[model samples]
Target: MKISYLLILLSLTLGTPSQIDVSEVRTAYIKASGDEQAVEQLNSKLISVTTTDDKVLVAYKGAVGTMMAKYAKGLKDKKSLFKEGVSLLDYAVTSDSLNVEIRCIRLSVQENAPKITGYKKNIDDDKAFILKNYNSMTDEGAKKFVKGYALRSKVFNDNERQLFQGL
Candidate 1:
């Protein structure tokens, strides 16, 4: 009975915004790869995830819209998604210059997206920003998450990877 209650309580508290874990969020994202339904569900969660009137919250919401665009096939659909995502990301970084995680999300989207979409323009600048400041992020989880993603990304060259790994 005690174990049952503990499990229930744990479940209840874990979903709360205050308890939201970004590392776990990133892990779940990685696990959901190639799973359409899982991606949709996770994207929905990102859209709904709460933040304290902060850039991270805005960025997550924007990222969800961007993910929705990823699954969209039409040119118009992708355009709409890109606009919302990029705008939110820009707003986030503008509001909080130190939001490396938010910038990471924006950079990832821009770097992988095609050049025709006009979203790739920030790829170099965001990469430079991330490389320059990521090591100094106070959040250990953020640092680890960014470094892991940057290492795997083709957008970052050997020098960038070396910088990430060195950190």
Candidate 2:
């Protein structure tokens, strides 16, 4: 009985040696879209994951960059932030071209950005890709995040929402 109890306790503590999970990290990031406080929290998390994969880091930075771009106070500040964010975003996507979650982040940013910014090119393709492979995602939180997004945003049409059914 003592040995069984010890084993269970060890799993609770050491089973999750890595502090961050990709799905959780990605979800926290998307939730931080316009909130400055959330963005700051995200930056803190991003910094602590030095040993994490480059793709995940890139995606987190891209999300943080977008938030900074949207909230930076001055025109010059905003422009600079936009440059940084877009650079990170491109780098992340290039590094992991087939990552559906990263593409979802880009889609969310572009769909809501001002029309004059010319960042709306991939909405259709991303929607198609996300829908095509969404069911295969192993992370339940990630699935819920995408489904929540599709339900709340103007990015998807009625027909598209139907496709995202039971997500």
Candidate 3:
């Protein structure tokens, strides 16, 4: 009975499940016809992603890049947003291209476009690194960090309200 109890305790102790954060991006729908409310809504959503994690910052920066790229040909003289996006993108990429999801978000932004000057090799390297680290990270907090990055990556669009989805 003592042996059996010890074996059971060992199994129970060793059976702890791996940790991960399940985050969702909240989505809303606004006018694609360039309404102020829609733009405001998108900006609000983007603003909400401001957090402490360096990875989240990088991911949000990528999202900002995508938005600036989309609105570049449309906005009248608001070169500010585009400039901000460029700065953020450069900062994030330089800070750590090993951030896979952030790099992926950057790629989805317009960096992958043929006319753009972005390179795929950087993204590929980041992706590989992220996957390797992700697979190896068993800590709940680290997993949550990765999930948050992923959540931020998918939470934007050319439309204004698309930014608020799944939150």
Candidate 4:
């Protein structure tokens, strides 16, 4: 009961300006388990997910839409499923710059180990952008955003180097 209340409070208080699909957010949030790492990831993702269909949002959007679309296609299609998962991961990271777990999850999304090398550049780009801009954010209400960003950078740097190396 206490956990449920906490989750609700977190969701209500942290909601972004864009209309968040509450049900979808809840579905994603519950997967966090009691693990601090997963919770951190979910917290980041909440900020990035937006309901507005704007070009800016779409440009920065990752693989979430593709992943959700593919998931809707069912599990029988292995190739599609794998690609979709990767896309979702990309979206998750794109949406929540602070969610570091998405970086870790990206590892399992790629089938070929060699492809990991290719992704290094992208990850490096992300890291540069994050490190460069995060300091500019100063609003007290957005401290959680800053915290999440730092946490993601540390985790991705330490645990998911292949993904972060490209940035």
Per TM-score, the best of the predicted structures is: 1
By TM-score rank, best first, the candidates go 1, 2, 3, 4
Q: By summed lDDT, which 10 consecutive residues of candidate 3 come out lowest?
A: 17-26
Worst 10 residues of 2 by lDDT: 47-56
Q: lDDT per residue, candidate 3, 56-161, as tens digits?
A: 4545544554454455555543455555665666567667665554554554443333344343345445544554555455545445544444444433233422
Two-way TM-score contest, 1 vs 3, winner: 1
**Shift of residue 8 alpha carbon in model 4, Å:** 28
lDDT at 104, model 2: 77
The Cα local distance difference test for each model comes to 0.73, 0.72, 0.45, 0.42
Pick the winner on TM-score between candidates 1 and 2. Answer: 1
lDDT of 1 by residue, 98-141 (tens): 77887887787776666776777777777888888886799887
lDDT of 3 at 99: 52
Model 3 alpha-carbon miss at residue 5, Å: 63
TM-scores for all candidates: the values are 0.76, 0.76, 0.43, 0.35
Q: What is the number of residue pairs that collide in model 4?
A: 11
Off by over 4 Å in 1: 1-16, 32-34, 49-52
